[model samples]
Target chain A: MAWYFSGDKAVYLQIMEEIQLRIISGFYPLGTRIPSVRDLAEEARVNPNTMQKALTELERSELVVSQRTAGKFVTCDEKRVTEIRERMSSECMEEFLSRMKKLGFTEKEASEKIGQHCAKNETDPRN
Target chain B: MNEILVCSDLCKNYGQKTALSHLELTLERGKIIGLLGPNGSGKTTLIKLIAGLLVPTYGSLTVGGNRIGVETKKIVSYLPERTYIPEWMKVKDILDFFEDFYSDFSRDRAVEMLTSLNIAVGDKIKTMSKGTKEKVQLILVMSREAELYLLDEPIAGVDPAARDYILRTIITNYNENASIIISTHLITDIEPVLDDVVMIQNGTLRIHASVDEIREKNQMSVDALFREVFRC
Candidate 1:
């Protein structure tokens, strides 16, 4: 999975968002071993403590479990991932639809535009 | 629990003028306090006095039930507004000094932090740029497992990117049982993490309350209240 780092928000929140995205994307599949805190911090160019906070949050959410000597690993429960994906996707779609409506696009027009864009990207060799 | 720190009618005069005038404050433990004020608002002076860096002109101050002295300094780790480390020393040398003086200093943690920042231990402070030196100083201050951390303008000089790192370091390094008093005019950057706030204006304590209490009472964010209170 590709690591995304941004300075726009709190590091811990950003890390959480990125990890959730990865889980949704199937890059970090259920029961996968996530990188060590040190490695992840180095990759993200953040302090390990920031990474730890993110991991702790993930543990709190029950999406990941930490072992004593062995590092943190994703829970082998696909139900949790599915729940998170559905919740996040619905929220994002609602936001997107609201913005489109604000920009004077009707529901059908917005859906048609999105479909055309996706179709073009699928067919285009450069894409 | 009520009195993590107590200063009774404290006064500090810098020659002709008074920096602090009969200041009285009681800081409780386990709270993240924001010491808010403008420049020359006696914020730094008050912090210095409590840190035992400067002696009070009149009254007495106690930290963790003991008077401010060598013992108090041991429990309090302070980060001054400006770079306080000698410019000639290496990063590793500063670590050694901290290790020598402060029993709570975590050398391994400091070294790990330097590595994470891609800062070499052997590099001299003179060779690094000003911003990097400031980060190194912050890392050192935060690595300590002190009871009271007085961070004076920790984010003032750094760039926006570095500010996040600085805040993250504080969040990560702070011991839960300890109290952190961050003195700064930059309210927006730190308003989210502050558990309590001590608003000081013109050498007087204006307000002191938990973040939740302040929000509940004012129905506004601390940043908004700061602007309103410190408005000219």
Candidate 2:
């Protein structure tokens, strides 16, 4: 997948966010090895040192584990993955609600609008 | 602590005009440094000094801990802003010349890069387009296993596709034991590829900081910062 940077934040931080998103979305499946720093840098059009820094941060957060000669793999811990997914979901919801609030909608009103939109889009939707 | 290049009180002059004045700079190994400035801000003069093409009027500069001379020249690979190949020479002839001139020149790496770009060995310099000639020059420079790479305006005057190719070549060829200094005014295009930026203004060093640190402090891209710093 092609990566686009916003240029306002540090490139390494943005790389970390993108890699985290890939892991949560299963684009880089759990327990699967990820691309090397050089390959990822080429794909993202960034410096390899920046890519290495991002991956090192990922390792610190326990989202990835490096096995020396075997390279790095996405965390196989289902609990940790679910926790990150929940955190991401809350962040998206909060951002959506905040934007809606700016347009004169309350939190409840925003929730109802999202439910209606999901009902229209998904074949089987919860009430 | 492994600094590959060091310059102390470096100054250069052209007749009565000062091109660079008392420039003190140290470059560590394995970094991609952006030598940035506006038109005639002494970027070219500083690079020429490092490349040993021009002598500094004052102070001292060293490459790989040795003074700029035959020993340092053997380890420093440079690409000037202009293409220097004779028009009648074929690609193979140029490759042969470099291979014979520098002990660290890699013929295999040069051939592989040329083949990948579809640059035939038999193609004469006169037959290639301007962009192609620049690419050939870059390929020849990067094919060396040198301690330092001084690329003067390597990405200027090229299409976006060609720019991407050049950046990729630089990224992939980068070794931990060497460093690359890419001099250009196109900050936005090469900002992400650079580890640090050395900004020069009015024949003096303005700022020399890491790319991420610049973004974090200014809350903007290096290109935007450059515009603000050099605003007319």
Candidate 3:
């Protein structure tokens, strides 16, 4: 899918988040070299400088590492990768739960609804 | 730090009608600057001045520390709003013309782009669709290894698909040392690809800032900001 962007946040931050998603999802596996700034910018249809800024931010956050001669690569630290994955998943859960709360559902009721939905999905032939 | 173009207190006049006034802007190398404004707002005037087509009536404008002359013209590739090529020429003929005229013109690169777009070299310009002609013109302009590209409404007359192709071509063709200035009113479509935006209003500079800074500071897209700033 094309990289999604909205008007509310900074484009570089959005790009940074997208790269983080890719790193966590193994689309760019651990220790694998990511695309160059030009390639990523072209793929995302953004300015190359903006892509460079996003990559620089990623490097600062330790999620990506730049070798001197070679290109940038995703960090190979399994613990750090797991930490980021868990953090992102938790953020998603927090947003979902807060939204559910706005709909007047308690935490327990929301979990129960999710459990029922997953059970139904598993039993369906489409699964 | 590498400023490619500088304009200081620049003014342009057409016998009492001021097309530009007291404009000061500096553009760095390696950036894609969006020159945005509504109709009659002097975007074209600024671009023309930079392209060395029209002389400024007052103040100073320079490209790469050189006055707008034969020297600057050699490094500036300009794509006017209209299709400026003769209709009678074939695509191959135009390619040859560009190759003969500009030392930086790369026939191999232009041909590669044409072949990828499935446009035949033998096709006459008059027979091609409007969008195809625009693409051909853009390809020829971009194939040049110029220091700066001044494209006036590159995507304005094309389809959405063609617009995407044009944008991609622009993104991939420019090297790190070269910069581009795309003047158009289509803000949202080109916002993502721009590093900076120079917004003009009624012959004055309204805003000159980075796209990310504008988005972060205003919490709105550059298009929304333009509407708010230029609302009638």
Candidate 4:
């Protein structure tokens, strides 16, 4: 219904994606303290119970760790972080390429368009 | 205690009018549920019944394993749609009154919220605007360590920013063991904070389902479903 939720599936899974994105983007960063469930829930405007389930999911994925009463922190594992980042990038590229194909461009042409966009300072050549 | 509120064939009639029909529902603890409906849909009536402001014409409703009475009152913190604080009383005085009236009320927590909201303690209640009054009342209700919170249109008269702040306060203030039922027509604004939704129409229950289930099963936001379900 709002940011971090697409309203197509379970909120905990959506929350998990959000936290993962934060991790992949270094918003949470490696080995840094994450906000409390109450704080995160408030920030997302979601119930703390749902936020707790998401945080627990993050913990199970080894992206976050709870140190007893000290609170939750992002994982210090850099390899896992890089893996998620690459996965997200590939996912985005796949979606973009598919959309480009739907827009009447071949796979090679779509890749060439990306190359062209990267080659020029301006993204659109028509301008 | 596990089930925060339970209504079994609960009916409320006022004179010749039936405000609420036979409604059966149960709310579990640790949930933030939205009591959603259009005008005259018995949303207020249900909230009032839980707040002990009205007597049901027939059937029963229990809150925190106790029927609606003095015992339930002790564990239930209610924020009515209208201002309940005395016009003559100052903000500080209201805190004192709440602390004296409700055992669960924590004056210090109330003071903390008041300070954060930039409300002066000595400011008379009548002098404040409508939105501020709602915020103050919401803070007071959330500060109480009660088992169940019944908020009737908690953000009806507030600006968007203040509405967001009030929802955040509700999320942060309530303990893990507590559950809150917020009744409002502003579905989009309040949709995110809701874990479950209870829809009522024409003095009867329409739907009660978890937000996740609704989303996964219907592939739409609760607001979208609400529009379709209550479409004219």
What's the C-alpha lDDT at position B61 in model 3? 97
Model 3: interface root-mean-square deviation in Å? 0.8
Q: Which tens-of-lDDT digit does each residue in B1-232 have in candidate 3? A: 4999999999999998999999989999999999999999999999999998899999999999999999998899999888888999999999999988899999999999999999999999999888888899999999999999999999896788888888889988968899999998888778889999999988899999999999989999999999999898
Best by lDDT: 2
The all-Cα superposition gives candidate 1 an RMSD in Å to the true structure of 5.4
Interface RMSD of each: 8.1, 0.8, 0.8, 1.3
B1-232 per-residue lDDT for model 4 (tens digits): 4898889999998899898999999999988899999999999999999999899999999998888899999999999989989899999889888888998888888888889889989989999999899999998998899999998998897888888888888878867788899999998777778889999998899999988889889998898899999999
Superposition error at A13 for model 1 (Å): 6.5
Residue B193 displacement (Å), model 3: 0.4
TM per prediction: 0.68, 0.96, 0.94, 0.94
A1-91: candidate 4 lDDT, tens digit per residue: 2365665677778889888998888888899999988888888888888889899988987889999999999999999888878888998
Pairs with backbone N, CA or C atoms under 3 Å apart (clashes), candidate 4 = none
Compute fnat per model. Answer: 0.00, 0.58, 0.73, 0.79
User: In lDDT terms, how accurate is model 1?
Assistant: 0.82
**Candidate 1: Cα lDDT at B208:** 84
In candidate 3, what are the lDDT values of residues A40-123, reduced to their tens digit? 888888888888999999899899999988999999998988988899899999998999999999999999999999999999
